[model samples]
Target: MSEHDFHVHGPHDHELEHAAQHEPKGFAGQLAVITAILATVGAFFSYMGGATQANAALLKNEAAIRKTEASNQWNYYQSKGNKQNMAELAAELVSSEEQRTKYRDKVARYDKEKADIKLKAEALEAASAQADEESAHQMHLHHRWAQATTALQVAIALAAIALLTRRRWMEWGTLAMGGVGVVLGGMAWLQL
Candidate 1:
């Protein structure tokens, strides 16, 4: 036969090549791809929820610090008695009282801010929890995916062994497994 004829009629010709490429994958590879995708989504929602909770805690701490500073200033003025220094002490008292009033107002504003933060944090936390629940379902999917992936890998290896030993069936199985692996890996990456 001519070289071109040999090429066209070869055992590994176009029809066989197309058939090998289009073969169905085993169960294991499909499961692994699904799980990896779910994990990526879960991690994202968890991070956002944690950030909101942290911000609320910080606002609460700031408000407490301001209240403490105002109280300390008032105490310092009171500690200095009202004898011959009564006028100066009186002026000091007025100044201290004004400072206390300003701080009190600030404290109120801070309290409102803190409350708002808490509300936001709670909402975020709820959202995070929902994400976590969804992830749990995904975990099961991951297990199935992993199992399928492992099985396909094993099948591919077996197919390689079969081909090396000149077994036709093994070659076909290997080709099938390879396709499965590629699809699963692609799916896993897309999940991210």
Candidate 2:
């Protein structure tokens, strides 16, 4: 061909050119862009959901460990009580005054140790409760993120249907669903 008549078209160029001329200008492009944006947001929400779930599990594990430690401390406190009881009995049964005084001293020491053990056990129990509460909160956030992801997925599906059916109302529905997804994601971020 002469340079004046020379032309080049890629495989889809003719089809795209014809479509651009026949279809409503920018409608397909707008839908494609919006769908892409929604997909990206959905991916982020999905990731947040997974992260929150993992955090909840970890917090729950921490709570369990703390609870176990508290149990152990309480057991130790009970052992000290038993020792104090044995010393009190020994003091009562002793014949010598000097031996009785020694048993009393032992009993007093065991009482003090039991008090310290009791305080530690209580503290650990409080910590375990706090961690358990935090874990529950994380699970709540995870649920929010999961809901947001589901809404975005629904929006993406609606976009696909709108494209296939060429329905304007479907496009509006897609936008509404996407907006709901964004709101849920925001709520998740705010821990509400």
* C-alpha RMSD in Å of predicted model 1 compared with the true structure: 13.5
lDDT of 2 by residue, 8-34 (tens): 998799987877797666778879999
**Clashing pairs in model 1, backbone N/Cα/C closer than 3 A:** 28-148, 28-149, 29-148, 29-149, 31-145, 32-145
The per-residue C-alpha lDDT of model 2 at residue 9 equals 97
What lDDT does candidate 1 reach at residue 69? 50
Lowest-sum lDDT 10-residue window in model 2: 18-27
What RMSD, rounded to one decimal, does every model reach?
A: 13.5, 2.9
What lDDT score belongs to each candidate, Candidate 1 first?
0.49, 0.95
* Backbone collisions counted per model: 6, 0
